[model samples]
Target: MDWTRQTRFSDPGRHHERLAALRGDVAAIGGVVRNLTVHYRASGIDFPPSRLAEIDTRWVSRMLDLDHERFGGAPLDTPRPIEQRLVGCCRDAALLTVAALRAHGVPARSRVGFAGYLVPNFHVDHVIAEYHDGSRWIGVDPGVDLSDVPLTPAGLHTAAQTWRAMRRGEIDPSTYGVGPDHEIGGPWLILDYLTRELAHRMGDELLLWDLFGEGIPYSRMEWSELPTELPDDLTHLDEIADLLIAADAGDDAAEQKLGARYAEDSRLHPGATVFCASPRGARYAVELASVNQEAD
Candidate 1:
């Protein structure tokens, strides 16, 4: 139920057990319409997709039957933001899929970003569910409604679709057709690790580590960089690290310039860093806090 973990997916065994349960639960739901709402409430995870799916699939469906009619319907004729349409559709699908997985006892989360391939600059969105399947985190894409939308993971609108392919042991992340969005770096790397680990559990060859391409650039000298010997308590170390990176990158002004986008990610130790060699040594480091904080 509480999928959050400080260790993330460090333990593979627990991940697998939970994932299998979720798969079975989702499969039991049977149909698109029923799976979204009633099935979601029965499942039990508390998140956006779950809550949203309950409303749309159950309340909204009863009132409107959006799944049969609204989904895949023509875009609004009046001039409006495409972002709104993309987010609305993807959000609905994600909530439905997430609710199904969580109902079955699998810890899952929803992810959204540009489709990166076919849509190019446009956001061709999709949702992927992350669940722990005992040994590791697994990914599933319930968004692939094969009867109506023939999913080709190789095409540009592929993130959500390819996620399903990965679940079916049909594809790998790097080759999943669409390029990743700009922000799917470390935090996402951890997220994908969970997703890919689940894929591996299903006798799938896909591995998250293998998919790390010229991933988003990471600065090698963030302030939070800690000594390899982590502290037993692991307290203010994270905050300290954040400050260090902000300082090293130079001054409050510089840190401010980088903004929350980098601030949220810049998870590294002040003294050490991880560089992606294949991506030509893109470096990443932690942030800084105060001087008294322990480096570890």
Candidate 2:
């Protein structure tokens, strides 16, 4: 299927009837605004932790189907526009944007990467939705709009782009990562996002905290020593990086090849468990097999 087409996650289906209901004027929305009331907050800006805890509903359909009461907000019977919604996370915003675009027959897909502009000397882990506008794929950050920063086709640095840039010494590896208290973004983080983004392009868009590879933990800081226990064949990353770039450029053949390669790569394949972080910063793992069975 084409990247623009909706999957189980992106498809709003009967939950939200029209794309008009989801559209928001980007000019009016600023970058720093966040939904303080919701349990899940996905920004550098902080918010009070929610009193109640629950598993994150990562799917766009599930997000649309959710009631305001679910997040301790006011009740709403139908889907609301972006301005009225309490979701400010990049993943949520990107998914909604993709759903809206796909509803209007636009080819769009969500991308996971790092944004350097968000923090000085740091590349924060971020996700954005990109839509093909006949000529090319343009990145759009639905979560925040830094009006001061000029927009361009390559404004957002994708994982693949970052990896290549880092390899060429164009950007410092120490500058790419998440969290303010510690160093998280580096070669490891870039590689992780690169793998995840590759999986995302192939329609296996796993949750933010989903673990891949044998030794890589969900949290980069958790590693006692950086770059420990990594795969012996790290050279494959260069090929994966090239494949991802090709896939992003709308090369269907490259995407299919990537899907096959990704599946065969034990380091990139979906693991038996997924690490989930709670509102209170508690981390736990869900058995992927059991979760799939329950979904089935």
Candidate 3:
């Protein structure tokens, strides 16, 4: 099976039965994550802090199952559709959005990167779902609805675009990172996004905490340690950036080469069981070690 092709992870066949069970507002779907941040303030409801702490659910089926379990039998959950439940982060939202789009015959995929406009002075870690309309791939933030906000490079840029901008000194690499307290930015963050985005483009969209190959743990390391930890040979990354751009534009050869290159690099594993940190700082094992093997 080609990693570029959709698999059970993106296929929505099993969700057909529940499609009619409840209706969702595409516009408001992206606001689900925002509402969680506000504690459903727009809805005038106060949820427990724990409601927004879990981040384990990675599959669409599990996410929908959890949604149904929380709202399926209750009329209270129906009145406010935007604030249904909060069980995931940006990656979960992107994956579910991709599944929803694919169910409707749209070519969609989840993207792992950073959003420069979401937070002040930081290129925050983020994920989004992109859909192709027979010509171009449009970025869609599954976690935040940008219907009101104008779409701009600052608001939402793919990992490739962000990398290019960083390479050309268009954007300050020091300003691109997770947050103020965790100033994890610069070349290391770009490299992390490159690997994650490359995996996502290849159809293996992993959870935020999931580790890939010999990728450095910049999230946990001190800023000074990043340079020494990163691979010595990084010239291939520029080639990857170009290949990603071509692949996005529907170049089959570029996609094939990208997949082949990724496969040959032992440092870029598609599967590996590593400890993943939750939003609450709790650590647990995420089993993605057999994902690529199973796909084959």
Candidate 4:
């Protein structure tokens, strides 16, 4: 469990040397990448198929290739036009930031969770980089444009936290989703993301839309038909949430149990291939690279 080592998703491959431009600067990540959906929408333009295809650049090497192709080895902090930035989401941003940190010998990992700071009164499903700052892990939002005034750092409301809150009637399920005005958030979303949270913690940082396991849903359409009521694998999810919560709280035994469960249970871990429910309306199986635990 060497967080400083790059996982398959974060490995920079041939671009490993260029990550030195980042030099573990999390704040500078915003200069090199662009939020795919936010970019097109903010510009009041529709996404061409090519821009949409960038979302499939799951590995950091591919993303770096795209960036190098567009910007030609510019320092990651170099300012660029909005259209010239690399297309990605919060997950990709976190992946790149983690890769940069690890390249510079920092113990960094991506956390798949929900964040309340993206939109007012809504917890958007988001990803952020968590690095060990000597003694404790500190979570920070990656990809902040150096142009904007720095905002106060807010905490990431993890999927485990959201699930526990929903079960306790502490928050509205409808408020947790991708965007503010969508019929997307619910217990099903939490269940799906909890598995994501688990995979990320286990070093399998995957795409946000990639769904694995037997019962996981591909999209909102599949998620809709599933029951909205309690007790359909709610107990199982609750167990997972508790383990994750305990592990985060410095319970070593809980961490060990959680790791063993992930290695043994295919339901909680991504297999060789996962179903990619692309945002552009397509579902296809994408293969995953095997983890090499001994690499470091």
Model 2 regions lying over 4 Å from their true place: 18-55, 68-88, 146-154, 214-232, 249-252, 271-273, 277-279, 287-296
Per-residue lDDT over 148-203 for candidate 1, one digit per residue giving the tens place of the 0 to 100 score: 12223322232333333334465434432223444333223323333332222222
Better of 1 and 4 by lDDT: 4
Using TM-score as the measure, name the better of candidate 1 and candidate 4: 4
How many backbone clashes are present in model 1?
48
Q: Compared with the true structure, what per-residue lDDT tens digits does model 4 show for residues 74-187?
A: 765666666666656778877887888898898988887777667887777788778787897777665544222111223467888878888898888887887877666776
In TM-score terms, candidate 2 sits at 0.74
Error of 3 at 268 (Å): 2.3
State candidate 3's TM-score: 0.75
Q: What are the TM-scores, per candidate, against the unseen true structure? A: 0.28, 0.74, 0.75, 0.86
Weakest lDDT window of 10 consecutive positions for candidate 1: 287-296
Best by TM-score: 4
Q: Which stretches of candidate 1 lie over 4 Å from their true place?
A: 4-24, 33-88, 116-123, 145-296
Better of 3 and 4 by lDDT: 4
Residues 1-296 of candidate 3: C-alpha lDDT, one tens digit per residue: 23224554554344544432323444543443343322222236544555544455555555555565666644212443545565466777677666655555567777766786778767777777776666766778755565322224676566777777777779876666666567556677777788788887777776666555665555444456655545566677778888887886778899889889889986554555644554444555666533222110
As for TM-score, the candidate ahead, 2 or 3, is: 3
